[model samples]
Target: MLERIREGSQGPLAMTIVGLIIISFAVTGVGSYLGSSTSEAAAVVNGEDITVQEVEVAYQNQRARMEQQFGEQIASAFANETYLANFKSQVLEQLISEKLVEQKANEMGLRVSDEQIKEAIFDIDAFKIAGQFDNDTFKAILQRQGFTAVSFRDYMRQQMTTEQLSTALTASSFSLEDEVAEVLKLQQQKRDAQTLEVNAADFAGDIELSDEEINDYYQANLSNFDTQEEVKLAYVSLSVEDLMANESVTEEEARQNYQDNIAAYQTIEERRVSHILIEFGDDEAAAESKAEAVLAMVNEADADFATIAAAESADIVSAEEGGDLDYIVKGDWSESFEEAVFGLEKVGDTTGLVKTEFGFHIIKLTDLKPQVTTPFEEVQEELTALLLKDKATDTFFSLQEEIASAAFESPDSLEEVSNISGRPIIQTAFFSSGNYPASVNYPQVENVAFSSELIDDKVNSDILQVNDEKILVVRVAEHKPQRTLALEEVKASITTQLSAEKTQQAALDWTEALKQKLLNGESVYDTLAAKSLEWNEVSGIERFASSLPSEMTKSIFSLAPAAGQDVDVVSLANGNVGLVKLTAVEAVDEIKAEDIEATLQGLANNNSRQSYDSFVAALVDEATIERITR
Candidate 1:
């Protein structure tokens, strides 16, 4: 149901309620425009190529975006081959549509000037440093993402072209008064309904069955009762947990591991500071003397640090506001300067003049964050477990290779492999291909158990890695060939099934009669009361009301405003039927001002969406297109 709501948001009204509607106007050339060129095309639109590399890159980018946005809940679906193929196909189609749109834009003489692209790039916040655009930051970001200035500008041009086309299409769709009124009337509409439940199981209780009927049904569907071929496995398992049971790390070892990797246990500590740098001139003593003067000024009782910094600091970028240099980790600055900064004991403490290669400096510590190190005793147990697991992991993998070789050298039994791994041989009961027991159902063990090498050829399997912790080698101990079940075995079950089908059919036939009676304007309540079925009255039902079944709400709303004295046969769960009589239709005679504006916007969006879809469809119809499979 939540999925249904998410899908419903794609419609005209949902996005408009939030005041924006997005149209897919991706310029497919962004992939190729960013610099990875392909000679082979996945699809060709008119004279232009939609390259194979482009589709693959787009597939990756889109897959990553979705996985990040939705997180782990839906991540596994991408591993499905069919889902990924269909996903790629949709991307290819979008690329084809984009190609057609690009051609149309060119034919329409749409143009984007270089100055426009420049302005767009400047306006982007990602290219800015200290609230203003920086050329180095812009170039570095583009270079990291594999875009040259020329190519990025070309990509921007393509984006602007598509956006211009979209704007033109949007402007052509204007909402008329009647359109808004008609939409508002339906959106605010309500209905009242009379409902009756006709249960199949109620009808089923009175139905009769006979020996002849059961026999006929059984013979007709005998193939449905065929028994699956199954196998029993003789296997040896290897696991980190089993190995850990025998593995241990001594106190000394845990302590040594802690000391060896202590760097990882320490968090970086730094100080936020504001410093006044005074550069040395021809006379080095004068610079030192000058620094002394500045220090004295900052030490005065009534000094404002920011006011002094703006007036006197030499680092102009930071000086515009204050002498702030942000946070500096230990290794980031000159040794003397860093020592002076870290030496200050608390906030607002000043470090006396310290000389560096660049100049002399007076520093104020505004904030200090001390280094935090986890105590050795605090993590002793954790380190022991980690060390045990590491050793067990190594032993498990080593045992895996030894057993794989052992099973292959012996080729017929589990005794040799089991001895090498120090685990007892396990036997699983007969299970069909996919239904192995928890102990033996490790990854490919299922298919390996049923494989001809184990079943017919009778050889041991190579070691299968179920996961990081578990591994298994399987050989079939027994094989049960497929067979059809005898008639006596399924006869009673078939009888129950056939009886239920006949009862449900009988109920359906009775519903048709009930529907005809209602259509003929017969008294609904009296007819229902005669059958001992209650007719319930419900009022003021909305279209998407969760109180009622979605199907019932849909049925109630299907009735037109003038649809009076109506009766319709609707389906219910477990093969029942709902006979609905929609009695009244209520629509808002007046709406709030905000809702009226929302309805108007919704109508305009609907028009734009319809026009965009039609325009794209028309372009697709007129194009010459060819698709190439990956």
Candidate 2:
């Protein structure tokens, strides 16, 4: 029962908590500047100080996650002043909300034990190796994400507590019968529609825009023609590959490593076992007596063991497959089951009735695989490669600091760093600050290159970690200021834009006239059909039907009248005008059981989300939050 409860709703709560802790957005990494601020407090929530360093760390962590998820191009877009301000505001709000939630949890006497936190952490797939939690992997991941053991454990505790609060809140918000009925009514209601599609391309040929119109559009939207500021960077990057090119592992070192970790190469013994279970339901005596009888039958020399097991075994899943459980290593099964299977020495050996929590099992040892290890000579190459990589990683880190220090000391050029670190000075072509060179795909390089300090002071930017194995040190070679393109230079582009705008307007005008005509009980279907603009009759489509196009469905379902009701002209995403008319509307009285369940579940989820949002909103309104920094 405890296991069932623990596994209930699976790991969504933990995932949700993690998402809250590290909310991803472009507004991240801007907090890095706050790390050095004299004012420690970034914000104060109910007299509690939210430190600048905390915001910086959160920003950096979330930025790294965003960079990884969306790559440098998308991440770089968020580096602008406006986006950063918005991002910081969002981050602060999230932090405040988290504090409020944590305070609420404390007030409610919610307590998450160390054991529970450990269990939650261990359950995370990211920290798992071979299906079990790995301590080293956990530490490594935390380190990569800029977290310490103490901080991460506290984070987990807070997350778990908040999750408990959330679970309670969601569970408390029950699905109302009326709400479900309304949802069912909406879902079940069907509309028959006739659609007329007007292609924008058809009207484009008829659109002729005057130069006055084009000039007006271009003049009004001058910002669109303005080019972004660009920079050319000269930098030197250090990677494990750079070290690996020169690094080599001696035979002696490889042999020593092989000897030290020999167990890693050795295969563990495995057993293939089949079993027949007789569960003790109401009558334990009857179950035990049946298991004993099955064991006796299996012990017979000519007994069809699989046939008997399939016919009589209470474990339905295994029974259907003739009770054949494939090869399993040690620690893969329950203790009693493992003990019973491992105790049987020879193939075809059957165990007597062995009782466990589930039931009594008549176990048969079907097969066994002996432990084996590959010869040292066969794995010598593999071991050498591994050792070389490890050596390269160590060398890369040691030299990374040296290169960064050298680059910073001589920011005007990478020549000094190249000479000091024995790395080549690489220069990039002039690229817009936001649109970086495809080859130099590091986010840190872009951040440093575009930084005001680097551009104005012309100082060597900080040595930035590109990834675990890569480090970059960059200096700006040339900076190009933002500029606006002249009217004549963008005249061709302006003409095309104006033409498309005029065409789209014409299409909308034509669509509106047709819609009005349809509302007045006029049949233009014959006229449209003559021009191959035939009206497609869509019938009995529900709100969420995939058969009809989404735009059509939206336009059709929005109608209230049973007879022809002209819907608003839909300007489709594909630059086509869609005019729709409701031909018929049908109301469904009897909803299917599955439909009801799905609708109710959706309503319950939506209600729970709203409740959580409202709860957070209420907390914020009650708490006195003060911004300490702009």
Candidate 3:
């Protein structure tokens, strides 16, 4: 289901859904029970409320990921009003789509049992240690991700149910072989070309920038130069691990825990056996005769059972291994097979022909292991650690309540909670929206640090849960307001910008003039010779070649001119211009089998995705969705 969500690429809405899946694990009903009224809802899908906080959290998480990927440049990009608005809309739409999917899944009667949820959690690589599920590792990771055992289980159940729905929708998507072949031909076709290029810098020096133009430009876009609001914060945190470090479990406690969970130490008796089978197909009598003969050989003096079984057994899987069936406990095999295997009382014992659904079997018992209990002394260390953790969990929650109460009662400072919880108060350097201090990574921290209440009234923030075992209370220590730069302070920057604009316009103007001259019976070679620019000769180049400029290739391949009128104007990516002339085109009549196979796979995948996308779109259109808040 997660992979299917990520595979969608129709629009920003699809990508937003993928981003939400990456950043969000579980959130209660869209409105988060902030209020009974729909006024606080970010959206309402089929009358189900989506809260403002939910959308904000999703948007903030997406912004954090973008900032991490692109650094300071992403912050600048977010400053654009248009981009920010579009992004928020897309995020809200994604939340609505999620709710729709969940509703559809429920309507379809999709369900995930407790056992399935447990298996899925165990299969997750994040919760595994050394390729197997470890309780300690699983708990620690869930705690770090702000999930309790119950909540994480619920999350996994929801994920599994949704996956069932997704699988059903996309199971029948495919593509035809001929469609794939056609795409391969088009994608592999190559073309040849030659071009004369012009650089924008050549004309930039000729165009001049005026003081009036620079002043007007700077005054018109003042928001571009404004600084973002920033704040400094002081906070105190309580951690469960810190309490566990000083807590210990005595031998008495360990013994009591072991006694309380004594059933976990019990094991069942198991057996190891081998068998030679004569399968009963069309002739049951023949099978019985062969089994009788094998049994006779086993009973004969100096007769090796393994050699006879290997040469005569119809069970090919175990024949090479001397008919070794490894190990078996009760409920591990068929009723008849189980009865026969356990009937033997001692090792090296053989049973007479045993009848089963598969055939007649000559059974030999090789080993037996009786049920046993692990002594308390052998598991004392493990028990002690478990008891200590349980005690720490109890103490941790107790401290959390105490600290929250103290912080709320004394809002002026965190000193009371810090002393009561034994956690020192910490301060962060100044930071702003979309740009946070490395030490402070939580979105709630930034939100509280910059709120009007924190800045204007200077009150302590409400206790915020950073994770399953960590809680924080923050207060603002300093504040900085937004500011805009004056024209005098940004005159040089404006001048540089205006110069680039003039140069681009001048280059476009020059290209237009050259194009008109070519259209009016001017020779391309003669014009380039007069202009003292060399022509780059390219032959048999691909439409998607990296050797030539992307804009040049796009223009050359968009449409071909008549045989004698192949000259066309193209814009280069470096704010320059180009005069491209198509020379020749080549067609590939055949492709390698491997290439065709790869192309076919890609086409099938894309077609399946398109079908799935259409299904989702149709679901959305039929649903009643309303924007209650923006």
Candidate 4:
């Protein structure tokens, strides 16, 4: 498995980092670690250090992936600590596996050639189109990832080498026909089962509790029983929405800005062309000679482009469509082929043999359209609205800071800030301590508003930063202390609690009774039905358990049911009781006659690898690893 590390602030890139970290184990040899100091490394395995720089790169890659998947959501909570820690651990495991694979490959003398690296790099789907590598497209992707041409090539080479090693390791390890047949047998197996539920509510009438006992329980758990303190406050918030409603931008400014950046408004002419590619033979002289002869045949004939394409073109899809490629804008095709096609004027015109990375192509212009630009009057309103929104955002934040500063120094209530600033004070009604009040739009603001210091002491909260610029300060208007309930007030609650306890014990007793009936050779299904419960059969369940609607599947799987034997009553995770009867036994099949030799060899290789991994892990465990956290 490959190891990866995650890093970055909340964004698309951050999410990508988190996902890549999760899947890093599959890649092998790469690991991620988090460290703040330059000298500190996240982890070291077998004397190979996982550096901070490597972690950062992996993190960025993960973030980019997240951005692509979730768009705006990637920016919200990508930097959450729980997420980052999990990502780090996963990436670290992957890195360790990658290093182990690399070490094994080296020991086995496995190496990648220059030609192999070149082919792998050129063949990447992100860098290619229509069977050819596009340099501009390749460069653009690398630029977005902050990688240079040389660095990308190196990265590709390492990936190719690692993949070659993994293929060698897993090539021989595969299930034999007999093994598959046995697995299939298990898949086809079925089971008959029954379940009984002991409802706790059924025994509620039998339980009894004294008033003194109930009072003591309530007092011991006062925090749970007492009413939570709640409050209402009034405040005004300055937001871009408020300012944008009143702000306006002049048409003259919009027009001038558009004219000043005229290049952004200009449109470029575009065309679409498609051609058949016949790759040259390995013999240089023969291939060139064949290409030239084919070019001459098409030129000499007065045949239509579609006729020539159908008869000679190697690209089956486009050739069938008479080389129809549909319309393309700028940066869509190879520079040489695009330049030639765009240079043509009249319809039915064709170019001479054009050689690109894919092969030689005989191009014919399909369609062409002249560039068009929108007039200033048509776009002025849109531009002015956008400009005014930007201006409002700036002005709103400036006013927010001034208001917050004044409120902090005066030591007054929320009303004082609202009154002095002439902004209306908003109030939230009494709310449970942990629950958010209905009036607040920002949960973080509400959280601070109800904090112990702000509520009980009646002090202004620390400036709360929302997004990049918006700030808020909150002060409590009223405080209510939590109090314990009297025994008379909580008697009904104690009665309900005692009743629930009794019902739970009764359910357990009922399940045990059903188990006894099964042991005495009575039909479990009949007993379950008699007790007002239901019996179900879940067939073809795999040994690797998953969710099941019937409680019997959970009970049966947990007991490791043996053929013709009954399991005693089992309680489920959610407090349901069940019993299971084993109807069949299945075991993995041994190697078959045809696959015996191959399967044995594969098992030997896997055993060898497992031994090697265990040895390495032991060595790593013995080494001292000191960490200094920042």
Candidate 5:
């Protein structure tokens, strides 16, 4: 069912195991199928219509997800029309890719049975409660993820079918022993090198920039000097928790409500049973006959069930304990076995041979707690709290509707909303898109505050969910549009930047002249004396060693040791230059067997991923995809 779909392969071909269930937070309720003819196609893949409604649904889901994770950085991007269009376009492209895969799978005759889909659903951990599958929990979780039972099943079948296709595409990669040993040797290799340093700041004192240069550079890059547009929001924040204190359930109402749903508050009886299991192997009839013989022996007048179980039961772990299985509820065991267990009248009562996947089981009722209905006096307070919570939730939703309507109708300000909902208008200090006030810390509030509807149009925003219990509606109270900073305000920083650029260029030019001298085999000890540069020699450093600058290390390693002594100039990260000289390279002759195997597996996985990418690329090229703007 839900096999380890991405067990080793690492590429788009590995799609994702979540794709197996479409356990989606980014795409709401998108199944692999077309809608009715009246539905409009946003794109067509192999003549299959991906409806405009599907794209919009997936887009909203993705947008909500993006706003939650990346709001601080990309909050302003959402206000840009081009960014919104591109975001929606990405959603459409993903749908088109999925459609192509579905078409290809259909052409290949790949399929998943309904029974397989059921098994997969039952196996999902999200759908389980107390380590057992609960139908209500399954349905609730599915509803939250935007799926009906039928649609999820269809989606599962499509995903599992595609999984089968994905597995086939990368199933053929392998590694040779020699290639693995060679890789292991290289991984153990170390290199020795030396670098002559040239610091840019050391040359800065000799360079100077004029005001004319600074002004010219600033004039050409005005956009870089523009301030980020900011806003102050006037909003009403409401919470269900704030309304809970006002809600109360009377004793009589609690009592009557408890009476109506008493079954829900009662604990289920659990049966603790033990069984002597007889496993069916090559001869099923023989095993069944043996199971019946064991059952007869346990039923004898003077027989000890424990003694017989320990002597003959095929279930080794339970057999050692005289077949003592712990407490179990109705769904814990298979249907045929459950029926036999539940049918037993009392403790010490034994059942006839029960046929199951494990074979036959002679089950004996060890103990049970009878189902108990909790008295109203004992649970009266709990029931009252629940009733009050229900009342509060209902009142909260009603108040939320009032706020939403008033906020939308009275777009100029939150005064109408404050009057209707009785929540006072809150003002936030001026905050940029990323930095926000504690009262309105939610991404939804931040996004709406920066949105055009609230800022440009000066209209109230749609009610935004701060959390399950809280919501916010906002409009920009003050708007500050982006403006270029004057040259006087930014003159000193521009001068410093231009000075650093000149110094860095000087360092590069100096390194090149030294590199040519080193290449001609002139001794570096004497060369350093002439220009005040010295070598930072490091001995036996590995390829990835951090003792030297990373750029210098990489340049040093790139040199072929077989090519004899070499020199290369490197641009260091800290505004400096590096003239690296490779001295020697060493590779260990021995590596452990486990290290070899691990290296081999890693290389093979890389090869497999590349192969899978090629396969998908080929399929994508073969497919005919049309992008429709309308």
Candidate 6:
């Protein structure tokens, strides 16, 4: 029963266990296992034991995730001996880290209060409505996730506590204003640069290869020349789409169904209304006086509503339309406005001053539409088409299973099955392992085609159920094996690569020579121009860092700007080299007041988190962790 309950929901078991542990800790001032006896201590940090049952629960929860994502076949492979070893190592590391962090949190006396937990929960958007916390919504969400209110709140509380612990440990790591200014300057800077690309084609014509060498290379790689075994497949798919196309429903039935469930399709009566809004300033007396003046003019007819709206209405959007608002359905407008609009009995009828969340408004109803029920006769054709399609789909899949069974037993051809089932058999040309044909998007069809048995020998697959109304059967007519390329077929390509390598070496040597000349008191621009190489400069380059392109920005910024000193050469992963020198350094622009406040808050949060992480790391280092794997 418990297994069934757990399986019915997609929520992770680890989260549930963590929530339970937190609740236990909160209630008893120490953690204890509540679910089962499998909870034995797994590790210890400064006499604080990490339970074995807790680790197992976490592991199972993670394994379930792997199973859900990759399916049973791949999940089994991942759970095997080799993969399990790696998984164990990762699990142990995480456990150790958590223990270390917890121990540090204890040493620092970091704690979370009930009031803080309640505040955090209320602040979470998921539990709020209309800018306020809604207990019903929170309970509904917990129920949907198979969690009790207590369990859900415990989970939230634990997360908040963990955050608190982190903040305590890392609060001191934040930098001063000068450091932040320097960082900001680097972030906002930009570089204007140009590159001189030396093409491989420039050296391609200079390289030559001998026939003898080519022949020797081909002889050493004969397997590369062998043709891969390619396969053609013959298969049949059945889907409800064909059945649905053929089925039909009568007019009488359509009308009856519509009458029986009129509320399901009936739209609410709505009105197209518009209004002239008069917004009040912060001063209550002034706002009231303005409202009274606008109301008196509207009531006296001295000024027409549309003309007055155009001249003085604060809601410019509706005022420009002569206070014309489009048709609005129930719940579309604010409560007071909606009530006033719906209360009108005739078009062009104006309402008394109405107050809503937006402001004061004098509304005029322009148009009205009464709710109407659609007649069954009017929708008969649609109903008929839907019924026909559903019938055709049922017939299609019913015939599919019979055809698949016959084809699988015969092992000779799909012709017999096609004739018996009266369904057309389609054929595919040679396809590679990773290639997915447009028709193979159906999971059942693709799975059958990729099966080892079907690929190895010409065999028909069993009827595969894709959905309730769809089934497929496939047979392999050909097989293909991947092969390498022979040297003779690729010799020209190799020669081109070799030539490009030599050209790159020559360019590097030239660059080096220019560097030495600069070091010997020669102007970099003059030395480069002497060799017909042009020099370019990039200014205000940002101090960006990334591993991609092999840290080009870092290398560029690392260069010194001392006069007569050659910039250190930096190599790129793409076989390019560059030399850079800093031109100038400047502080960041003045920070805005709001921006300064935001920065301070962000810095404080980051510092807290860092401290917490360091504390955790320390605890993990001092702890004894053991793993008993099955």
Number of the predicted model whose lDDT against the real structure is largest: 5
Better of 2 and 5 by TM-score: 5
Model 2 stretches astray by more than 4 angstroms? 1-172, 248-379, 390-412, 415-439, 456-462, 523-526, 529-532, 546-549, 562-568, 627-630
The weakest ten consecutive residues by lDDT in model 1 span: 18-27
Q: Could you tell me every candidate's TM-score relative to the true structure?
A: 0.71, 0.59, 0.52, 0.57, 0.63, 0.55
Worst window of 10 by summed lDDT in candidate 5: 1-10
Backbone clash total, candidate 5: 0
lDDT of 4 by residue, 404-500 (tens): 7777776566665665444676666656656656445354565566677777667776555555534555667776667776777877988777556
How many residue-pair clashes does candidate 4 contain? 30
Residue 163 CA error for candidate 4 (Å)? 4.0
For residues 203-263, write the lDDT of model 2, one tens digit per residue. Answer: 8888888889888988899999998888888887777877787888889998888889988
Which predicted model would earn the best TM-score? 1
Per-residue CA lDDT of candidate 1, range 1-630, in tens?
333333343333432321211112122123343445556888888978888877777777677768878975345556444566789899899878878887887776676677656766776666779989999987877776666778777876776665566556755678766666677778788889887778787787778998898877777877898999998888888889999988989999998989999987888998999988888878899888888988899999999787888888787887885889898899989999888887788999988988888788888888888899999998888889999999999998888778989999998888899999999888888889657687764445654677788889888899876666888888888899999988788887887788778777777777778888777767666756766898789999987788776677888888654434376777766677777878888877866667778877877888889998899999999999999775
Ranked by TM-score, the better of candidates 1 and 5 is: 1
Model 5 Cα lDDT, one tens digit per residue, 1-630: 123333422234344553434555313444323224466888888777888887877777677777778974565456555667888888887777677766776777776667656766776666678888899988887666657777777667777777666676556678888878887677668887777888888778788788788889998999989998889988887787777788888888998998899888788889988899999999999999998888889989988888888999999999898899988888877999999999999999999989999999999999998899989998998888788778878887888888888887878888988887667888889888778888877657755677777778989998887656778888899999888889989988898788878998898987887877777766667757766777777888887788888998888878876443477888888888888888878878888999878877887788879987787677679988888886
Tens digits of per-residue lDDT, candidate 3, 1-630, equal 534432332234432342344224433222221223444688888988888877876687678767877986566556555578889999988878778887888886666678655655665666568898899987777666666777666656565566556655665577666777777777777777777788778887799777888878987898898988888888887777777887998898888888888878868778888889999989999889988988999999987878887998899989888888988998978888888888899989989999988999998998999788899999998888787778888988988778878878988888998998887888988888778776565655655667888889888888877667767788888898889978889888888878877887787787778778766767666655666777788887777887778888877776464754677787676777887878777778887888878876776678768877887898899999888742
Residue 196 accuracy (lDDT) in model 2: 74
Candidate 1 colliding pairs: none
